[model samples]
Target chain A: MMLAQDTREPFFRPEWVSRNADRIVEQLIEHAYLTSIAVGVGSLIAIPVGVYAYRHRRAYVPVTWLAGFLYTIPSLALFAFLTTYTGLTTLTAEIGLVSYTLLILIRNVVAGLEGVPRDTREAARAMGYTPRQLLWRVELPLAFPVIMAGIRVATVTIIGLVTVTSLIGKGGLGKFILQGIQRFFSTPIVVGAVLSVLLAILADVLLLGLQRALTPWARSRPRPEGAR
Target chain B: MSVVSEALAWLSDPVNWSGTAGIPNRVFEHVRISTVTVLAAAMIAVPVGLLIGHTGKGRFVVVTLSNVGRAIPSFAILGLALPVAIKLNLGLGFWPTFIALFALAIPPILTNTYVGVAGVDPDLVEAARGMGMADREILRRLEVRLAAPVIMVGLRTASVEVVATATLAALVAGGGLGRFIIDGFAVRDDARILGGAILVAALAICTELFMGGVEKLARPRTSTA
Candidate 1:
């Protein structure tokens, strides 16, 4: 607070903080919204595909691997390439982001679902539970831990990647960073960079909390008495 | 549209492969740049990771720092660093790209290295010490050998990711295969876009295969587990 008075630059001046505070808050919210939307959409798309593939086992390996490969494409290039067909707009960016997430989320979901100990599902089936009941009451609950771990990783990764969405002209912190670069001003760039780190941290913490909430079983189980 | 045909023609032209316009040369340079960055990041990340794991000190510090590295988002790092580079007249291109990709690649290498080493059977290490192996020898002869496969898996994944991501360096006008994809946008060339995408995808798979073979060769068989 004390250092700002010596700055000759207007934006760097102390008084500007009051004016920009709301915008910064709003920008952070907007950034969070965009990332959450992509994750939500990716989950919707991926869950069924993941479940279906997990059911079919051997047959889906090629297709799921293809999804994983596509998931590995760098976000920036994918957005730009999509823009050639879709044009530079929100739809293209959204589609690219969602597609990118599906690869991670779906594979994780499928892996998690498959990871459900076979005995549990068999017990559910033996107890005369319907297939739907098995999924909802048995498999889903047991699989929740691994599924959320995947989502947690995916969310943190997306929050960081969303900063690049500004390059496609989505007008978030990235725009400020890019503009600061163009104008040779470091404050806006610094603001963007600092917030990018903060955003990643906050997102990880939030998702970690959610993971814990969903996976109570993971923590409740103790390590074997003698184990490291 | 036609730009695709043109680029294809250019690429297919015997002259393109003959190193004219430094296309072949540029390909080698880009590969070299990307490969060196991945190796360099691994060199720094692996030992630091191994040290942290072997010592079992500052566990939180090491992990929290790696998480920050993972979270820093490559483009923002590049954006933040570029102005500093430009003003200092360090200029921008491969080195800047190398730094950014290196930062992005480290977390995977670091995390995997830590997991590979720390996850080793404690009893085995104890036995090795009981057998009177020196600390240095224990690390090189047993611990690292036991950990090699997992660490190599991480390197294999990280290298593919780095090559794909080095494409982003194009935004700052750093040359790589990303040019074909980004430039394809201005002209609306799907073929060029697809070609570039295919090339990147191929680059990833090729690196994975190459690394997988090396991983197998280095990995000790008949686990002492």
Candidate 2:
């Protein structure tokens, strides 16, 4: 109904959704899978780097600068450039997606850990806690909310970036978007765009739930408004 | 390594420097669209941000909108816009690309402006009021002046983003440096693709540094005043 063309295909036909339900679900799963792998790998690398940067102080600038530099590269450009070497593999897609998450993940991890109150660490140390114990018990728990905030942002960002991967022949939901653009079909475009937005919202909400459930003691505190 | 060398060779080739599809023309197209999009977004966002920041009303809505806006992917916006553009007979490339990039650029400027302006010390506003200054005077002389740095941060963020995203304009038949990448892929020319990527990345970095310099300049002047 949204189209003015002679064919007049409805913007979102229920029959089309029913007929192509398998494809839609498959793309959704692919989108979610790519996002998780990127964020998961990104977090594994970022947390240790963040901890090191937090301790060394000198490492902070270089790590963040590298990440920011990578982030400034256009997603299309990165993916296109990578295709020459990596081919159309998911590895190519994951590398680009993971690179995008590094800035958000590392910055949040450092900020969250640093945000721990100084006096709390002092009090723990006064109680005969070891440096390791103080970090594990006193600092990380307090930093959990902030770290989780970074993860949520990274997750959402990766979901969006995954769409660009379709251009290189490896996107999940983005495949549909590219197909829609090429064919000039409203049904697929609407389906793809709507589902992608919904997926982002769903991921965000799920992470918020996880954040709240994990931090029972911090429940009384207000949530941070817009982590970035 | 050969990719890098070949890409450099492609960039350094004098033949690639002329014509409508040349490096200069593509860079011009890229900069033109990005500048217009950022400027258009600012014209709308800055005033609305000023109102929200100064009045202390609609803070929650604007913040929530920015949060949602951040989550929406640029490609999705472009995909959605393409159909509407076609339906409206707005042609293919530039209009859809502009609409998408414009949407992408607004949130940072609006949020930054609001945060910068709203964060001005209320006590300063009160003092300005005591001096018989109107709300407009207080906003222009005091709040906006203090908030300039934050607003610039927003502009810098938005500018860098716009420049980076403008590359996608090529995908929709629009002319830009992105044409090299898209066209490179079409003809399987790795050198041209990498060369184009380098150009786009370099442009984005220059925008970041330039805006940062502007931000620094804006900062010291206000403090000295």
Q: Quick one: best TM-score, which candidate? A: 2
How many steric clashes between backbone atoms does each model show?
0, 1
Write the residue-wise lDDT of candidate 2 on A159-202 in tens digits: 88999899888788888888877777767877877788789999
> Per-residue alpha-carbon lDDT of model 1 for A1-228, expressed as tens digits?
012121233334345446778877777887788888888888888878877887888757886777876676667667765665676787777787787787778778787887787777888899999998998888778778777777877787777777777756774566666666556455677777778778878877888898788777778887577542
User: Model 2 segments beyond 4 Å from truth?
Assistant: A1-10, A220-228, B220-225
What fraction of the true Cα-Cα contacts (under 8 Å, chains A to B) does candidate 2 also have? 0.63
Most accurate candidate by DockQ: 2
Q: For candidate 1, lDDT tens digit of each residue in B1-225?
A: 454465566557575455423356545655877899888988998998787778887678668866777677676777766555655556667666776778777888888788888888999999999999998888888878888888898788788778777776666667877766666654766666655655666666677778889888877878553
When summed lDDT is taken over every stretch of 10 residues in candidate 2 chain B, the lowest stretch is B216-225
| Model 1 local distance difference test score | 0.73
TM-score to true structure, per model: 0.84, 0.93
Clashing pairs in 1: none
Candidate 1 residue spans exceeding 4 A from truth: A1-27, A181-184, A210-228, B1-22, B84-89, B183-195, B223-225
TM-score, B chain, candidate 2? 0.96
Superposing all C-alpha atoms, what RMSD in Å does each candidate have to the true structure? 4.8, 3.3
